[model samples]
Target: MLRIKRLDIFIVKSFLLLFIGTFFICLFIFMMQFLWRYVDELVGKGLEMSVMAQFFFYSALTLVPVSLPLAVLLASLITFGNFGERYELLAMKAAGISLLKIMRPLIILVCFICVVSFYFQNVIGPIAQGKLGTLLISMKQKSPELDIPEGVFYSEIPDYNLKVGKKDRKTGMLYDVLIYNFKDGAENAHIIYADSGKMEMTADKQHLYLHLYSGELFENLKSQNVKSQNVPYRRESFREKHTIIEFDSDFNMADASIMSNQATTKSMGTLKASIDSMTHYGDSIGRQYFKEAMGGAYSQPSGLSKNDTLRIAEANIASYNVDSLFEAATLMQKQKIISSAVSRTGSLQGDYSFKTYTLETNDYQIRRHRIEWHKKITISLSCLLFFFIGAPLGGIIRKGGLGMPVIVSVLVFIIYYVIDNSGYKMARDGKWIIWMGVWLSSSILAPLGFFLTYKSNNDSVVLNADAYISWFKRIVGIRSVRHLARKEVIIHDPDYSRISDELNALTARCRAYVNTHPLRKIPNYFKLWMSVGEDNEMKAINEQLESLVEEMSNSKSVTMLTALNNYPIIAVTAHVRPFHIYWLNLLAGVIVPVGLFFYFRIWAFRIRLSKDMERIIKNNAEIQDIIKTNNNL
Candidate 1:
């Protein structure tokens, strides 16, 4: 017990060291990826160092749960792998400590980590996500510094475009400036041309003011009364002009409260509350839509019957025949009736379209919130799941360090990431159910984790290289002859010539039977497949030959032994009988195409069986001749 305690301590200590290092390393990698994504928005904006520090802090916090699973995966893999590689695991197992017992301590640690991850996701994650979102918005709103280039029109300013031909930067002078203004409206556009201009932002950094040495202002008035292509316009010439453009160039942080309404920025409790509220709202709207669709009530005219329904009431339709109604009414009356009916249908269609869109939008929002709610738990639970996967996988592979472990870990994480991300997007887009999409990765990997753990505990060589190589060989048409060990038996004085004669007669009979009784009729195959039957005569002959060969192997005759080697072993592998696997028949019957496939497949097998019988006859004839030659001597 003392030794086991020491070993447990050593394992935990080793795992902790690897876990800490792997955590930060994985965190750094994720952080670098995050940086790459937002570097464009973050770089060269003159952001304060403190703000950048805060951004990095929140970003790291957000990535903790993200990196936790992979870190635990890598760390667990390394820990167990190092143990296995150094034969420490073998020693522990040999000393009566099972793999599960060895895993007990680390499993507890991982469970604790899972709880902490859940807490982080529910508490810290939302806050960091909220803050990060707010900061990013603030950054996006922060205008680029007041540096306008020459030649191209710079329109970063609100509703205005400006161009400068040249600038004397040393003296802060400009030449040949053109400006376009559409602040009021695009149709009421205003253009300004100047020989020289200078632009500067206000001291408050809220606006840009342009001063021109010589400029002309032109404006167009939009009017519907003007029939000509050319509308009325105004022009003014000035030796010097000034224009002011609204531009907020300061970095003002947005209110975090502004982002509090988003699902990503909400805690699990908040998300649940919102989901319930929205669900109730959606249900109410759906009920209302159904009520409206069923035409619960309508303000019909006083003369209309109460029995009249929404979609062509019996009395109303019966009273209307196009030819008779047209004959009864004047042309003007008919036109009026048709127009009223068309207008009414058009109104109802527009109303239904609006209601449908409203319901769809509400349902989509509900799905997104529910998706996020499930994501909170699933992502947290993934830490434990990945531990199960990585730990057993490492024990199975029995490799350590940065070589195979890295590749396997990365590939597994990539598959998990792809599944999780795809599920998230699909759920958010309403393509999949909330729970299904949110739990997709966990659901997929949980069984895999169990399977690997089982294999590891059972000491199964699931990743054996030789097994895969054998399968590969079979795929490419390479077949090996089955070899059997020779049984030690006391040779008996037997009639070798009689044995050979019997073998030759059996082979000729089997060959003749196979050729004549080959499955020539399609109905026979169907009957055999349906009844799960085989040719009993051939089966009896095969059994007789096997027994005869067994008896003759004890003969003190070399020719007999050589002949036995040529004869093939046989079993009833012909048809899947009715009393066989219920599910197989059910599947084959349910999927008719596959059943037909098997039908033809069995037909082809019968042909191959006939050929096998022929080969047996030829080999038996050779054996008979060999024994006969020995007898003649």
Candidate 2:
């Protein structure tokens, strides 16, 4: 229950943040739209005030769906991002809470939101869109406030055009109004002339009242002329009282597109019927292709050719793939196209229409439309998918400052967007199955997010300990191997230079091998005990090394002599591959031998000096045979 409450709080907070932020942003966009549409008419064309107000209101409603999903995504990200940044996620982890346990409530909230979003898509969204469309149409038809000068006439309204002059604002009156109302046929159309008139809009702005002091209405309804007889004509004059012209009903509920809810998609049943019809047509196309393959006398063709019966079957397949063409067209329609107004009409050629017509007969359009419909449903469901991905990712990247997290989120989203759009295009072109195309990105990303989250939950220190140590050494001027104390007393006059030369020779051999193979290069200095050469290399090298250590001991390097006497079983094993370069192994081999040898040499010298100092203190006998070996340079 406590867990449930926490999740509830999270979701509510996320939704509110998203809703408020998106609403203001979308509202501003809608206001700009309203201004752009009627601004020219309002300023230049002198359009009225009421139309502008209605336009904005309708525009805002139509833009809700587009902004809603974005708001939801942003809000959810911020909420979880804040939690992760604050180290609350770490605290939760320390308390032994599983990631899934933490995210459970959030997922439940998203599910509820999914239902709400679906409702908006199916119900409220359509109504708002319909109203917006109707409002735009009305704005196009309605005239703004007439801004005629004192004594000039203007004629711009088409079909039954009017020219009025000398307007009086106080009485809403005008003089010399010439109205031209056309009859059925332009050959015998009659016009009306009014000497003076007063115009007033009704309360609802539907009807117009014309109070003409003197006016004549003429009608020239053409009749069959019997051998040069005059055509029938009628004329009527009106004076004094105003003539009320009732405009068409302004607010017919039935006239609103929303009243015919299924106009956008005829019916839910129609979509189902369309799916069924397409399936049947696909089956029929398959049958036709089969029948076409079995040509007369059933003789197999020697080679593939368009004229061959099998080739005809293939052409039939291509023709049946007219569905792909229709699907492409449907996608193109859904994608907003930019074209000049002058080029819009009659742009679709006769051949194009005929091809479309034939395809429609075979249920091509319905299949294409079904693809679109499914794509939309999938896109909407993607919101839920992204939420899953984002929430999990946030928990994982726990270093959630705005900068890193936001950058990562945006990059992920960009990749997702590109993939999803590519899939959508492929599906539209019939290059991919509808479900596969629509769901591909989400399917790929969701698993990736899960893997990342799981990896993040595991305890692994990402920083390198060796690297940190190296940095410390560089900073403090510490050497890799520190110097130790020396030893006393000389035992053997060993050729120390010869042993050193042999060590160098062995190192050079390793280097040469490394140069040739390039990948298997490691020193084996400690392997003096392992060599079984015909020259007894191991025994000779060990004896030479022992003698060099004895010389160093006599020179009072105590550590080296103590090491040689205490631990004589020195062994080395080296292996190298041509393709694999294990650099750390190479480093270890170089460092360990060199480091230990120096330390032992120093200790042996220190021990020798201590023994000489003790002999001097005892005053029993002078220290003798402390001879240093010289190399033949």
Q: Can you give the TM-score per candidate against the true fold?
A: 0.67, 0.48
What local distance difference test score does each model get? 0.80, 0.54
Pairs with backbone N, CA or C atoms under 3 Å apart (clashes), candidate 1: 532-577
Worst 10 residues of 2 by lDDT: 570-579
User: After aligning candidate 1 to the native by TM-score, how far in Å is the CA of 451 from where it should be?
Assistant: 1.3
Which lDDT value does model 2 have at 123?
61
Segments in model 1 whose C-alpha atoms lie over 4 Å from true places: 32-47, 167-176, 182-197, 211-243, 255-257, 289-323, 326-328, 421-433, 470-633
Instruction: Report the C-alpha displacement of residue 67, candidate 1, in angstroms.
Output: 2.1
Tens-digit per-residue lDDT, 33-117, candidate 2 = 6568666544543444565566666566555544444444545566566666787767767778766676666667667766765
Point out the worst 10-residue segment of candidate 1 by lDDT: 475-484
Error of 2 at 501 (Å): 28
User: How does candidate 1 fare on TM-score?
Assistant: 0.67
Error of 2 at 573 (Å): 24
**Candidate 1 structure quality by residue, lDDT tens digits, 4-28:** 7888898789888999999999999
